[model samples]
Target: MATIGRFVVSVVGAGEGHNGRRTAAVARALAFISALIAFAIAGLMIFDAVRVVNEPIEPDQVDFRLVTGVMLVIMAAIVAPLGVLNLIGARLLGRRKPRGRTSVLTGSLLGAVVAFMVGADAPVVVWVSVIVLFIVTAVAAALPGTKRWVRGAPSPSESGELVLGGVG
Candidate 1:
């Protein structure tokens, strides 16, 4: 049990003292990439849904087409919001705000949930990629390094003195 706890802590990078700035940068990048990928996927889903809806359907196939198109639209709706959340999180992280980490983490978890919910409908590769991306993003945001960085810790400078009084 203790070993498990230790491993979990290490995985989350708790206790600080690591290369926070770099870790935060990595987290920010991951979030942005995840957002872009999600947006792309959502756009594709929407396009496909529109195509399905516009297709000339036989009388017997009308229900099937409508159901499929609606499901696609619903999935796209779910995915797009997560992408927006991730985008917002990335922007906030760029500005060095602590809430950015929370936003990224939240977005990641929600995205994972959405991926799982729609797993059967999506291709294996697509769902797997989404899951992996969200998990990595969440882990990055949860890292102690990212936490420290987002909290605005001073970086080590050449003389080890905190630099103050810069641009107005």
Candidate 2:
């Protein structure tokens, strides 16, 4: 268990020298996970929409089926692109690009909106958890430390020594 925990920490970049980089790494992981979840949800939405459209329906229920299927398809359309954005953001963040933070922030905000809009029928706990996940991801990406890290600023210790011309 300890070994697995250590491995997870290492993979997440938690062992890095600076807090900024560590937080940025965490944001990247969260964004990546959120993107995967969004993709899965989008896939399920597409599948459900197809199933609804193909299922046998009584004449009076035709409108109901059509509306439900169309709604699901629309939701899927919204989610899949956001998922792609999140994936791109996560990849760029892993590379320490400044724009990665912007992308991730945008994706996180949009994702939270979509979750709130589409999760009306979901269990309260589940819906809230999804919202919380988005919020946390946004907060992590927006942190000062994360911003500095993504901008490629040297850590304080490194900066101070260089700026002061090093006492020897």
Best by lDDT: 2
Off by over 4 Å in 2: 1-19, 59-62, 153-168
How many times do residue backbones clash in model 1? 0
Q: lDDT, candidate 1, residue 166?
A: 44
Q: Write the per-residue lDDT of candidate 2 for residues 1-168, one digit (tens) a residue.
A: 999988855644455565577788889999998899889889989999999888887776435777899999999999988888888999989877877888999999999999999988889998899888888888878877778788785555665544455452
Best candidate, TM-score-wise?
A: 2
Compared with the true structure, what per-residue lDDT tens digits does model 1 show for residues 1-168? 999987755655554465577777778899999899889989999899989888886876435777889989998998999999999999988777877888999998898888788766778987898899899999888887888777764443643666677422
Stretches > 4 Å off in candidate 1: 1-19, 59-62, 153-168
- How far in Å is the alpha carbon of 114 misplaced in model 2? 1.0
Cand. 1 TM to true fold: 0.76
Instruction: List clashing residue pairs in candidate 2.
Output: none
Which pairs of residues collide in candidate 1?
none
